[model samples]
Target chain A: MSSSLTVERHPETRPPEQRTHRQVSTLPLVAPSVIALLLWMIVPLVMTIWFSFQRYNLLNPEAREFIGFGNFTFILSDPGFWISIGITILLVVSVLVITIGLGTLLAILFDQEFPGQGIARVLAISPFFVMPTVSALIWKNMLMHPVNGLFAQITRGLGLGAIDWFANFPLLAIIIIVSWEWLPFALLILLTAIQSLDHEQLEAAHMDGAKPLALFRFVMLPHLSRAIAVVAMIETIFFLTIFAEIFVTTGGGPGLATTNLAYYIFLKALLEFDVGGASAGGLIAVILANIVAIFLMRSVARNLDT
Target chain B: MGTLEMTRKNSRKWLWAVLGWLVACLLFFPIFWMFLTSFKTEVAAVATPPQLFFQPTLENYVEIQARADYLNYAFNSVAISVGSTILALLLAVPAAYAMSFFPTKRTKGTLMWMLSTKMLPSVGVLVPVYILCRETGLLDSRIGLIIIYTLINLPIVVWMIYSFFKEVPKEILEADRMDGASTQQELRHVLLPLALPGIASTALLSIILSWNEAFWSLNLTTADAAPLTAFIASFSSPQGLFWAKLSAASTLAIAPILIFGWFSQRQLVRGLTFGAVK
Candidate 1:
């Protein structure tokens, strides 16, 4: 059914016998991957469903029994769900704002012909490749530590008080760290988009007496819309599941200040061993992510289709 | 001539360059600080005034090596990353070639669906995956990590290789086919050369993904096959920051990939932007 309705591209010059066999089997050659993926996908999903329906707790195997909707109900009543939801939304939005906002501006900036541009470009993009755990540790130990951190040293030198980033604003701290890691990726994508923009069109705008602000508003922005949308979508997908940053920084501590959905589920499964709660929470998180994804993909796909 | 206007344009360019430099520094400062701290003594690393001109030493690097068997962890990282990338490429190349050159009706949906798996929070199936690994007796092994990384990185590899293969003119393949070339010959002589850059980038991307992959590494690896991520994490304890040793460990862990990325950044930049932008 899928093969019948989809846009398939077969090599044009297969032998007559080969074509006959191809005709016999209408599905494309990529079926192996699809089948592999289906198995990989279905097995886990089925396991999750099975686990969710049964009363499953890691510590209480003998007491485990079938309790349909019981785990789901308990999950619905748990107070951490609301708190984690709120935190997840805030983390997602804040990281999105900071990364994309800074990324756009940096992309425009780096789009200029500056000295040491090679090294500067590399620096701007390096954070993207750094592992999340390393970034968190670097931020936690070297930069943001209250007593011996770079921030503390600088503040004291400048005749100011040292702020404990974790203690004062744990969620904000996590947001900053994640934004740092992802900002470069956004910058690179947007910069590529900016570079792909038509220089002649900008010159034409200038010839028409359009100022810098007018050119940016009318010319550069229109070209960047799709790039921005792509960055937003991809970044959201990653940010929605940020585990290492929270795991390393606060470990979702100080009363769950920085616990997003991913880390919350992590705590449930790994720490609390609440398999049912974690599975249901994960499913809910996936749904929440998909909502944003649908809109993001539609816009980007529209651009792609063009 | 418009000499005054030319001077104004030059001045504006200079201002923009300055702003760009400022932005670059803001972006790069943390990494710069990490490098700087790597050479400082434990006390001096945390000292006030930031100790810009301290008697630089490799004390941390020494301590870090003494603390843990660094070579063992580094070797695991190398083996696992390289091994997984090769495995992923082997599977992905055939699969991607099939899809790109011979897309079926379900191609678009299938590709999108594969990509969507990446969207699923990895932690969602962490328990099942961990349990499966344990039950299968694959936990804490290099091969185990390789299998996991290969699966995680396969979707992207397929995506990249598919796009790369698409860029190859379909007519090229037909010409080969009309000449009565076998499938193996056509692929060997035709597709490989044309898509080398893409394949190289894919390999590089996979290696980097595996190298820096921390979550599964942390959860799955214990002692023997634990990679550098866990080695760095061992420095982290409830006791708080051990600046010099942690710095040394961090630097050692990140340096190889950093250098590798620097060398391959151009290909990487293009690869990362594949289909998303220019």
Candidate 2:
């Protein structure tokens, strides 16, 4: 492990006078990374703005022209845009509700000193480690498939015909897939937050004859507010751009029922090859997602201070 | 009365434990079923009345191997995941180290900016990035996949590593410098060793993210550079659906990462909750 650098035995702190220059040298260290992100991120973001103003299609290269917000207008007017927005909202909200609900419950369960806690914790968090595409495929195929899926098997076991879940409940199916991938993350964070809770407060609540729900509401909820908010913000930020899940499972199928914002932009570009319209759509989605993210990030940022 | 109350609480505890396992089973059964069905024949797989306890066979896996040599893609997955993580760490460690130990007004802003890059829809730049990759001859290559994944995982890596680095005091590095250790030497001897837990955790977390990454891997790599995710995707095509085979592919894809996650559940949980709770 100690290959190159020999450890000098004497470790001594530098004087305050000499430390300022040493600290200032950090400027050079971060510049390359910062500049790379700016060009790679913000520049393309600005180009998206530019493309939104033009009429460009990869299919018809000659049709490309400066449309002066025409692309944005068309993009906004597209019927799929609003539908996708609604579906995106539905996707985000449902995932949050399910994942956070399961997360907190599992966190509380794992928090208790119990036998097999280690294995339960492991099994509980295993879903989060799955690649999104693979998870979607698994859920779509062997789990939710009307014929061969376990969902179908279980249904038939109950003396019912198999349920075509994606065909019938595309949005719900997508919600479950994303939740399976993210629930472990929420659980991990929530459980950590729970562990940080003061035992004294819970003991006091117990002494005061507080019911379990009352103790959870009064004693635990406030303590968890920041962690919960962080969890919500983190999940929301990632959930907004979930593409592989939608792409893999339903492919926005069952008549656009599960066309989330990310998949919509993907379809516009990849399937339709409408570069300008898709770019505009991408910008629109960025704006819409940013509106949600900026608020969440702001709250998390404000909380990060304390 | 108190003894009765204690008994009530004990029974409730048992109830909660039972409830927890039940929930865990429901959540995990899909995976369990996929593994189970992988051992079943395609006929038994799609029988009208599904059977859970059929004689198992390796037919699906054998057929899967005939369809595609999975080991190659699995190897690519291993290479791409480890490669991206190492590359991301090479870049992010120094950056995180400098920012965490050396405070400035813009440090927080820089961190936020890095993380905010993730908010941008990846598909927004898909064509451009795809074009760049094509022109640069990086598309459908392990190097290319590694670069894309490194960028995707970089922000979180820096944030996690920075937070981990923050837990190590600046005074230690300062001490190293005072002992005539060069800036590079100080980082190597003091910062690196002291931050090994954070580094080890950062490596593990990045590996997990890269291993589980799907969007870029699917869109970017097709055959030559395809990873396990794409291996799973090959089961899907315009030809028609192959549910049993698809399940076999996906089960194979996730099994490695799931096993790793199960083994390191504690560390993974700790890393994911880096600054979240504290």
Candidate 3:
């Protein structure tokens, strides 16, 4: 996926006059996308920032006033805000650890010369295609339900009582559901990376009598390091903003157990109609996302250079 | 080299295959379970010690269409996803073409900046976007969803298409140019055909992502413009368990994209990773 820039300077490429003419034509062609994205990024962001400082509510539009950090102060002092931050970190970290760890193992395993490998891999990654709403409901009702769920049936068969996953462990439930959806993504990326590994390099390592674990640590793990990093960073960006799973499964409750920043803001903006408060929360989420985005952008920019 | 060693190797191969299949089935169980339940009657769906064998019925699927007007939501999903995909392509093809063929010092920065916009948490702008939509009376409209979907996905579409366009050799275009071909002629005759497969895959990815998108579809629309995402979410209410109906709806909702996803699995890595992995 290296840029085509390297190829253009080949001696037979276009003449300087034609190149300049094409460059001149490029602007009009690219302007629409640039302008559209600029508006899309700036307008809502500016509105959110402006609303964060003002006392605005959808229910009482005429009562708007400049509150000047009041919304932030309230959000900071609120216990739910702190709890949601903790839950957000927990969800993102746990999902990353599970997906990346399990993904690497699955990638290596499936990379082996096993019969039906292609079909197995296809089935394994199908969950990535399931929409968030459906995945959550499938886990909540079919697999995790206390009474009639598959897990309940298994537990009861073992003479144990059925456990209500949402009621008992809301955050864990969200983590499992989210992990199921994302593990496939990590696996897909890491597998592609691993397959690109030089077979001669692996054979040379094996010839040196490196044990299975040692070979994995020295050869495969190092080869996978960049892919794992990419997967982790990309997953972090998405996981921080996970909403529909909590919305469908727990509704951010069992007393604020599963409400990440996204759902928290959604509750404020829509349910409470507290536009100022939600906007303040919204800015906080954006700031958090930007912190992660900086690292991701830097790494992806490095790829562009290659 | 002995017979015993050959037997041991074959046994180990079988073991690995079995283990692989087991893991795959475990991961695929929930989706397969939903598929199975969709064919069962509602009562049998929730039956204790869930039924593995039963007289399969299409009642649940029938009920979904008759009671919920399933086709309306399906049509919305198709229109929003396909409409947004086409709009995104229209904007992206030109931009990607320019960026790929013409090198500028800022081109990389421009591409990176566009992707960074995608990382802007949707919730961060939810409050304002919702308000803006309401103010313009675009709320709960297909056009509204299409516009928002296109914007949200524009960066990815541009990035993917850009990478694809970068794969086309510059000599082809230059040769056409030397033949006195106009810019439009060069594009039509030289570029589009070379890049059509990439563009098609990009559009497939865009449509898949748009179809499965829950946030905007859930928030921005209700009955009038609700896509399948919102339709499935409606089942999350604490009403009596319609497990069979929910499964049927879910199966219907995901079937097309699931098949699309399977066919495009290889491209998924390239498209989703912004061409970094590939």
Candidate 4:
């Protein structure tokens, strides 16, 4: 199975002269990016791994000493670390569910014939272009503030008390903001896939007296499976390391309510100056991300063959 | 019976059109609200029931201009985003050309390896990179941030350009070779022209990504070198009654890129999904 997958994905290796030129000429052309990426990938990573085993802190530059997994043990035993891991998983999973669910519905909605479809699409995807800091601040101050926010105004108008969004629902707020940013991406991909569906099949099914639900279950859902898988894998890779939104809005606070693994490591490394502990946390993040990366790579590789 | 079916179909179409418009407005409300609030006065911006009509003011834009050097941050943003995009294209174009036309047994592995480098979370190497920047005296320099941006974006650029190059017919290059054209001559005379539109779109996407990149820009730069991302982030701290000013700054930071993004949505899906979706 593995061999066949490989054979299916890779193009046949034609003779060098027949394709372009000798391998020597092309090898040099490809060397720079490969070499830069190799160094970029290797140098800091090796340093991170090495730092994780030492008693190093940026505050005490001269007190460095070998500690041999001491940092890992400390981080593992820390409750904050576990909380962060839990929060990371929750954030990623929640955002994925919200974005995919809303995106699929939006894709179907936009697929219908409308008078101003093009303009509507252009407006709908605008949020994806806003910078993270801008979106976070807009949500925090303009929309979600307890007193002066739009939500607050609406609640008061209806004679209900205003709820402080960040203080009360920090993680959910972050998830909502992140989901808004990414929903356009999922919609664009899924809409493309839906548009590519064979119309003749849909027509035939309709002629056979299939109901809307039945048509969707039998025809549309099956066609969208690959696109859905692609969206899930790609969004997982990004949502695992969400930073800027949390950084700008809550600072991972209300006391760690929004602190995922990435912000947790940032706090250790930059704020507290604990290089050793942060490096250990960084390695753990690498491991977690790689689990998702493997699936994404396989899916992308499969797409390359066709 | 046929007239009744027509009436039902017409009503359904109207139903869908109304639903589509509603969803579009819901999705776009935040940005539209931001744009509207930018033109309101400070008191008007936070007013209850949200002022639908007010005397528009340029006071926020004027205040931002007089108090802060908005142009300086805008310059750095344009310089870094465009500069890194060009640098990445220089490195990526040749590499993509080689991998697409010359398929060695390891080419696929190499391409995937490049992509996997992107997957490694930037936080994983934040400490070492931070220390390296400090030690090398590159902590707050534009050049330093440009280099980081170039390195981070190189993989996507190479992949996007490679996909575009793959669409170029091999027979053209083979014909050039038959005419005894050197590699440089063939690339300059033949291949580059054919692939120009794809390359342009790829470059545009890279610029958009770099422009909106907040993590590194926020972390790596302080006062002198801060881009628009960092500039907007500085507004996160509570300042007494500056909603209008903040809105103006946010609008300025996102406007150019938003225009660019709308134009390149097709390339964005192709590049972002790594050609899997398109």
lDDT of all the models against the reference? 0.78, 0.77, 0.91, 0.89
Specify the CAPRI tier of model 2: medium
- Encode model 2's per-residue lDDT on B40-64: one tens digit a residue: 7778777756677999887778787
Q: Where does model 4 exceed 4 Å of error?
A: A1-22, B179-181
lDDT of 4 at A266: 94
Off by over 4 Å in 1: A1-29, A296-306, B263-274
Off by over 4 Å in 2: A1-14, A303-306, B1-9, B170-185, B238-244, B263-274
Candidate 3 lDDT over A1-306, as tens digits, reads: 322236345322556676676688788888999999999999999999999999998899999999899999999999999999999999999999999999999998888878999999999999999999999999999999999899999999899988999999989999999999999999999999998888888988888898989999988998888888889888999999999999899999988989898999999999999999999999999999999889888778888841
lDDT of model 3 at position A137 = 99
Candidate that would win on TM-score: 3
Please provide, for model 2 over A1-306, each residue's C-alpha lDDT reduced to its tens digit, 9 standing for 90 to 100. 112133432212445666576687888878766776677787667777777788877788798789888887786788988898888888888899988887888888878765576677777777887788778877887678777677788788888978788888888888888888888888888887788787888988899999989988998888777788878877787787788877767788878898888888888877887878878887877777677667665764653321
Model 3 DockQ reads: 0.78
Binned by DockQ into CAPRI classes (incorrect, acceptable, medium, high), candidate 1 is medium
Work out the TM-score per prediction: 0.92, 0.91, 0.97, 0.96
Off by over 4 Å in 3: A1-13, B2-9
Cα lDDT tens digits for candidate 3, B1-278: 69998999799888889988998999999999999999999899999888999999999999999999999999999999999999999999999988887867778888988998999999999999998999999999999999999999999999998888877776677677778998778778888899999999999999999999999988999889999999999999988999999999999999999999999998889888887787
Please, what are the lDDT tens digits per residue for candidate 1 over residues A140-234? 88889998888888898888989899999888888889889888888888887788787888889999999989888989888888788878877
| Per-residue accuracy of model 4 over A1-306 as CA lDDT, tens digit each | 121232222234444465553556888889899998999899999999999999999899799999999999999999999999999999999999999998988998888887898888888888999999999999999999999999899998999989899999999899989988999888888888888887889989999999989998999999898889989988988888899999899999999899999999999999999999999999999998898999989988987742
Q: Between candidates 1 and 4, name the one with more favorable lDDT.
A: 4
Assess the local accuracy of residue A187 in candidate 1 as a C-alpha lDDT between 0 and 100: 86
